[model samples]
Target: MTPLRQRMLEDMSIRNLATNTQMSYVQQVAAYAKYFRRPPQELGPEDIRTYQLYLLETRKLAPSSIGLATGALRFLYKVTLKQPWAVEEIPMPKRPFKLPVILSREEVMHFLEAVSSLKHRTLLTAIYAAGLRVSEATHLKITDIDSQRMMLRVDQGKGQKDRYVMLSPRLLDTLRLYWKAARPTLWLFPGDLPDQPITRDAVGQACQKAHRASGIAKPITPHSLRHAFATHLLEAGTNVRTIQLLLGHRSLATTSRYLKVASSTVCATTSPFDLLPKVEEPPPLTPTPPAHF
Candidate 1:
């Protein structure tokens, strides 16, 4: 039983899955085992299907939850247990695609202005300025900033892959001011405890507070900043492929979604009203008709 869990962890690590993903997969698999009061290895495809049904019908879990369970089971059987046929027949539920929320440049400025703490403000600014996920922002180090090259290095980003993103001049000045005030020794945004980096929860709470203060009313989060970054860049005439590289996205399709969010795209299109031209009535139509008659 121990070996089964170990094997699953090994498979996850081998794939270089994101840390959050690794944790979620492990937890989901463990939950399945706990639900049956038996090791996951003892379960076959039928059991997997039943568990999925239980999650949906009995637990009334969200689609995302069900999807995670399906993914965990699939990985367990296919990768760890070496019984691909057992889980191959199980079908994953379809998830609805939704566009990310994006804040306009002015709204983002207002949100940033509302942040009281320098550390929190700078961290949030860096997130938008560099198009970083909150996790990446919180884990940033002084060494990661390449001032000369104007690039921010993201280590072990979303996919456990390292990548570089642009660093704006305004963001650089803000960081310099923040550094002078905080004098951080290790992590760029260190938590209250010296040993660890600032928690993602801290960044989230800051965003919530700022959102309330800004009165934007759009259900914004730190991620919305990243989305806004992409949308604004696209509006600024940046290429989608270039945005994809900057956002660390694996596919151009993922980056293409920003085209819809871009203000330029929305503004550049012809309006419905423009399609119908107003017609002027002929002033002398009656007189001309009478003359013709």
Candidate 2:
């Protein structure tokens, strides 16, 4: 590897960034350098601006993607090179607040049932039942499932933190049946190799197949199951803070976004008008006539 790349990797390692994040940041910086056909270290602030514009107009990248690229470059210049850098020079694109697409309970049931493979079905059931990210689901170890306690241990989930999620009886039953059929030794959902857990892409592909077969056209994904889990819990009157803990969200604000999408919660909530007592306004005209006189 190049000295620049090595130094950047070390910097990211020192900061304890996730492997995925480190790779993305490095890749983005490499792309930025390649765009100009010149060494990134040789580039200036104006070059960064032009590249940002290129990503925006030429490449038609989404605002979130542009923001990620800008962040990567900012880290490269500011941290790795120790240059006089200002992140403000490259303004972040305004990201639209899109509510997550959630599945109804019936839709979720149909989608899960449509998954043909017994193993994939069980894996997805665990994800939806426990509100696990695909990464968390794939990485789950056999030992992580606490049958007696009725919770699943998620190790090194997003932000490299560990947490426990409630294990539903239905999910447990499915997992038990799957284990009996497949005989996975270590990983709860082992991949083709058996030694390794299933890949994230594999889970995504399985979800797509199930979605096509189920005919619930709400644009579902593995993460959408997680969204459905949170939304369903909120709709069922679970506390927002409890959902926050289950999802391992660092901010309550992130968990609270489900309120916008939870149909039951929105429908059940009393509006300000509904809460107010009725009052008549009949004395305004008499006061107005006296003021005019």
Candidate 3:
């Protein structure tokens, strides 16, 4: 790696950014440099603006993608190069507000059952059972399973925070069966290399195949299971603050979004009209005299 890249990596490490975040930042910066065919340090605000336009007009990247690229460029200039220009010059694109697609309990069951691979099925099941992100699920170790406490410890989840989520009795049974069959030594789901955990892409591929086999019309990704988990809990009457803690969301607003998608929660809610007093029907109006016309 070049000296500049090494320094940027060190800066990210010092701030304790998540591994996935660091990787994304590095990749985005590299892509930005390649686009201009010049070092990022030499580029200025005008180049960044042009590059943002290129991402929007030419590459047609999603707002989230452009935002990530912009963040990387901002870090490269402000943190790495120590540029005097204000970081706000690198404006992030506005991401559209789209509600997450939630699957009903039956749909979730059908999707999980369609997964053919035992390991993949177990991993996906655990994610739905505990409301875990793909990265957190993939990085799970054998010791993380606390059967006695009926909880699973999520280490270094998003934002580099550790937390515990409930372990359903049914899920524990499924995991026990998987453990006996696979006998994972270190990682709960070890990859082909043994030392490393299973890749998120592998889980994603499994979800894709399962979605096809299940014949579900709605999209089914690993994150979809997590969405279903949160919505289902909300429908079951779990409080937003509690769910926020369970999901490791820094903001309660993030967890409350599930309320919009929770069908039962939305439907079961009492409407304002229902609370209004009942009124008898009024008499039919008589025709008004028009003799003056």
Q: Please state the error at residue 213 of candidate 3 in Å.
A: 0.4
lDDT of 1 at 84: 54
Worst 10 residues of 1 by lDDT: 284-293
Give the alpha carbon lDDT tens digit for every residue of 63-83 in model 1.
888999898888888888888
Clashing pairs in 2: none
lDDT of 2 by residue, 183-228 (tens): 8899988888989999998998999999999988799999999999
**Model 3 lDDT tens row, 1-293:** 98889999999999888888899999999998898999887889999999999999999989999999988888888988988783868887888999988899999999999999999999999999999999999999999999999999999999988999999999999999999999999999999889999998899998999999999999889999999999988888889899999999999989888988887767887999999999989999999988884
TM-score: model 2 vs. ground truth: 0.90
**In model 3, which runs have C-alpha deviations exceeding 4 angstroms?**
269-293
Clashes of 3: 0
List ranges where model 2 is wrong by over 4 Å. 269-293
Candidate 3, RMSD to the unseen true structure:
5.4
Please identify which of the two predictions, 1 or 2, would achieve the higher lDDT against the true structure: 2
> How are the candidates ranked when ordered by TM-score, highest leading?
3, 2, 1
Which pairs, if any, clash in model 3?
A: none
| Candidate topping lDDT | 3
What C-alpha lDDT does candidate 3 achieve relative to the native structure? 0.93
